[model samples]
Target: MNTRALSSIFTAELRLLVRNTAVAVSALLMPLVIGGMFVVSGLQQAPAAGWGFYVALMLLTVFGMSGCIAAAGTLTYRRDELYLKRLRCSEASDATILAGVLAPVVVVTVVQCLLMVVVTAVAAESLPANPVLLVAVIVFGTVCSVGLGMATTGFASSGEQAQTVATPVFFVLIGTAIWAATDLAEGLSTVQMLSPGGAVVQLTQLAYTGAPLSETASGALPALGGLVAWAVLGAGAAKRYFRWEPRH
Candidate 1:
């Protein structure tokens, strides 16, 4: 990969993201709204379990809406506009192009997570017990979300329809997050823990409560495995089905 070329593409992608108000609102503003609600409702000051759940919910909000839906829309729009095809004809390799497009969202999501942590710490006096796990989960969650977005883009015929194509996926991810955050029967909780979103939730819980490594690992293994599976599945589907040209 050409460092200069990648940087240039990332800058252009960032500019494009900034120009699209809908993208900005979906990717950033909406999550902040939800986070604000948690603050306003004083959930941040709740018991350890409740605080953990709030963080998990916020993570899902930002990751699903931005990394998945917003990213799908941007990529589909670029495809419809022949931007992706044009990039292919340039010196940028496929990897560079994809990375460039993904960089901004990943950066934004990370920043959002950090800011959320800070807010919780200051306002609610809640801080993650395992900061490293929290960071790891955020990074992996972003990767999976972006991969899922690209995969979802394969179903969109145009930018206008991208969100529609993404709706089911959005719901599943968000729904799973909600389920994971709620108390459930033991069997059901185990199933939820193995879901893509559940994996992220588990990590968030560990970070929030500072569970011992043995317990955290026992739970995290399944969640991490699920996350890896989703990443592979999404990336493979995108590579196989992503449209490089507008459909007739």
Candidate 2:
């Protein structure tokens, strides 16, 4: 990492994030909204084992909405304002500039995650039994979300267009994960494992419930592999197709 340039770029991005109302709201407010929804919905007992199931589903739910919004909105704002173009003309390298642009999204994701855990622990009495596993899912999940957002920016023309461009993926990611984990979609059991948030939520739920998913390398390895693949795919797309300039 180019420390000095990265720091300056990060600082500049942070100021922009502070000024961006949607980014700020999604990072801070959306959690409260979802937390409220979860509490209202209530956590019913399932036959499933492990704390990972619940924690993973919950965190993924948070990520699907808030993380996507932050990523798309931030990218659109920067691209629209020619910020990415301007940065390219500066002393910052492409990699360093990209990192700085994503810093706020990463920070927001991490902080919101901590806040979610604390709130869930206090309010719902649902604690992450294995903090290590939870951290892994979170760190990986954030990376995937940021990368996905960057990839999605290829289609976004303006900040106002972010919500429309982001909604379909957001809905699919959250909806599929929730439906797969919950009893609602008992039919798709086989392929649910292939869903975007599938492995992450499965991994998280396992982390939370303290089940024996880890004992079976047969199952555990596949889920880990899937999440890793998604992360790589998302990052790869961003690297190949992410546009720093406005589309014609």
Question: What's the TM-score of every candidate structure?
Answer: 0.90, 0.87
The TM-score leader among the candidates is: 1
The ten-residue window of minimal lDDT in model 2 covers 183-192
Give per-residue lDDT, candidate 1, residue 230: 75
State how far residue 46 of model 1 sits from its true place (Å): 2.2
Most accurate candidate by lDDT: 1
List the global CA lDDT of all models. 0.76, 0.70
Provide the lDDT at 176 for model 2.
Answer: 71
Native-structure RMSD, model 2: 2.8
lDDT of 2 at 59: 70
Candidate 1 residue pairs in clash (backbone atoms < 3 Å)? none
